[model samples]
Target: MVQDALAGAGYPQHVLVACSGGPDSLALAAVAAYFARRGHVDGRPVTVGAVIVDHQLQPGSAAVAAATARTLKDLGLAPVQVRTVEVAAAGMGPEAAAREARHTALEAAADEAGAAVILLGHTLDDQAEQVLLGLARGSGTRSLAGMRPSRGRLLRPFLGLRREDTLEICRVEGLDPWHDPSNTDPAYARSRTRVEVLPLLEEKLGPGVAESLARTAAILQLDADYLEEVANATFERLREPAGGGHARNDRTGIEQAGKGISLPEAALRDLAPAVRFRVIAKAAAAVGGQQPSYQRLLAAEALLRRHGSAGPVELPGSVSVYRLSLAQLEAEGQSAAAGVPREGARCGKLVFRPQRPSRK
Candidate 1:
């Protein structure tokens, strides 16, 4: 079933496997290797390279990463590279910060190996946990939908399978899985969810509860996909390009500064609530300059729904959107109720003013 999905998705070809020495990832790496040897998804043969990221948070992390690389080498998989990623303990919580760093490191390794697809080991269990977590945070449909099977260059072949199944496979394959103590520690919310919450939920609700949640996520994914399609179509009618100058449209830049975006008030009023939210999201992303967090998106949508308001709303540090009667742009935080300048006329042709000169 897993191999068929990879074949259907054109994955496990020139693949970079994220192996953390845990049972889930180790099983994934081994299974991918098995399929690669058979040339199931490739004309020439598939090449599997293992990438282990050392977060360097713990004292034994570097040695563990080295050992993981050696283990993969013993299994006939060459080491593409081992990377050490640093995460600052601020702004983002520890779990979120570590995840971001790990993904960044994995992407870098995949790029270095010239790999088109990167395999992760997210299982059905993880999907259930994510759905529960999203509910806890009161997030939107996207979060409730859980992790995608294939996002960008990343692919998770085991998402439909269970973690216990992977562990069983590892035992049968004679692979010694490395257990992370963090999984059992109560210090992390995920650990608590895995050890305490999931078990209680299972006891109260009976088995297959996790599976039921996984099924919910799958259904939500289909719905999300359809909604995104609608959003793309609506975006075509609603989008108003930013005036020239400001920042270049380079998605690769960090702290994207000096970009301009605008929206048509008439156009916004025509769409339904759902379509309106989607249009705002795209415009904020495209020209307002950065990807707003889920929370910020909701806040922006709220402000828009109320008063057909004009002016700025403060978001997380250093990010704001100016909803002028005529235009909107991503800028630093300011008072949302601030009076508009008389000269800030509703000129059909709004010009972009750069906050600062480009590095050049």
Candidate 2:
């Protein structure tokens, strides 16, 4: 499993394992060390290192980070580094903030270590839990897809392995693993899901439930990937020409992107609902808008005359979308109702623009 991941990554010169003193990450570190001793990967010379991030959330996080780094070094992994990060809520939950902080620390460490790829140790159980969380939130297909195997410079070789597999690895390797108290703390949603929800589910659904969810995620990933490619291409094609051209100097650059960007209403109306929704989201993102939630996307779709025309549908990131009215169409020299199509003609256009800030 590990070899496949390394080979797929093109056998980079250096790899950095993000360890957290947990059984999963420790098991990954051991495997990395085993590979490093070979002195080469896929006929290419390679080195392995470790980065232990201390979120400082618990009382002895620094001590745990130190111990993890020591263990990795003992495994013959070189240049072990400990990163301390400050996790701020930043309008998100503490867990999310901590994850953001952890990634930032890992990326900086990877750059400093000159590592080409950073390995994460998210097991199949974690992927199952992620899918469950996505389901609970009523998330879209992409969210239901769960965590990916490899994203850019990060790889998760352990995702195909179970949590028990990691535990057995630790036992056989005689490696002591820290059991995080947060894993059982009811104050956290993930803890509650892991402790209460999953066990109850297993009792009724059998042992294969987690594996089934993981498999489902793998399948959905393929579908989501293809649809995303289609949506990306469609978004580009459906956009109206800005300033008689699509060039940046056409006065429709990123800064002015949120100002009066238009998409053909008919083209959007013609698309499948799934593809259309994704296309709308892609456009919003092009104008620097945050990804709209599923509900927000539905609300945006409502303006296709499928629902009542509520003016100025506000998407996230201060962008608003609205279907053009007949008067507005006439103002733009578009004559659809008159049955005369001329240059720059269309039945209608959905305009996305920066919403004027409301007074406090």
Candidate 3:
């Protein structure tokens, strides 16, 4: 399955397996090495290597990293590298921080080795856990979609495989897998999900809960992808050009009317709610604005559809959206010229403005 996934993703001549000496990664390393030694991943010869990122969060982590690197060498993986990463405690908590740091190190290692893709060790269980967490958070469809099998330079070939399969592979290969202590630490939500929540769910809901959740993720991923494509196309159509060209003032280059996106009120009102909300969200993001909550998006949608003389609705980052008519735009221009800026404009059409520079 791993070889098939690699091949399907356009098997590169050089592949890097992210190994943590765990059953999943070890299994991946073993299989990747086997295929590489046989002169092909999906039928083409390739060079396979292993990269173990030591996020030194636990005691004896360095020793564990060394052991993992040695194991990778024994598995016939060449160019085994152990990269040390400093995990900083940031807003997302220690577990998230460690994950971020680990990924950064792996990318660097893959670049150093000239590997085209970095293989991850996430299994179906991990995908299930991720879905449950997203559900708990009440995040949108994208979160429920869980991890993709292939994302940019990262590939998770085991996403369709069970954790038990990796363990069995390790056993058959006579490989000793190091169990990370963090995997059992209840302090992490993922650990709790894996150790307690998933097991309890399996016991109560029958044996296939994890598999069912993974399937849910796979289905939602398809929906999310299609919606995103529709949203991108809609955004392009609705976005008004600036100075007869695309909006390029901001780093993101999303065309802006003023400090926000201006779309024809009719055009936006005609869209389905799913597509409408996504367009609103994309507009916010294009202007380098934070994601608006559902309520906020609804408020924006209402102004467009209901035809109200309402709002200088406040959004995150001190950004504001207002429905402006040609008359209102003329009035605001007069007010600005008269040295008294309008406080807020009535809602009739959408208008975006660039953020004003702070006075020094």
Query: CA lDDT, every prediction?
Result: 0.70, 0.82, 0.79
Alpha carbon deviation, residue 45, candidate 1 (Å): 2.0
Candidate with the larger lDDT of 2 and 3 = 2
Residues 53-127, candidate 1: write the lDDT tens digits: 888888899888888888787776765478899987897888899999999999888888888888899899999
Model 3, residue 85: distance off in Å is: 1.7
- Model 3 residue 283 CA deviation in Å: 0.8
Candidate with the greatest TM-score versus the true structure: 2
For model 3, state the Cα shift of residue 23 in Å.
Answer: 1.3
Q: What is candidate 1's local distance difference test score?
A: 0.70
TM-score-wise, the better of 1 and 2 is: 2
Estimated TM-score for each candidate? 0.80, 0.90, 0.86
**RMSD in angstroms, candidate 1?**
7.3
- TM-score leaderboard ranking: 2, 3, 1
> Candidate 1: minimum summed lDDT over ten consecutive residues — where?
345-354
Native-to-model Cα distance after best TM-score fit, residue 273 in candidate 2, in Å: 0.3
Over 4 Å off in model 3, which ranges?
241-260, 305-319, 332-347, 352-357
lDDT (tens digit, per residue) of candidate 3 on 18-76: 99999999999998889767877546779889899988888998999999998888878
Q: Which stretches in model 2 have alpha-carbon errors above 4 Å?
A: 241-258, 306-310, 333-346, 356-360
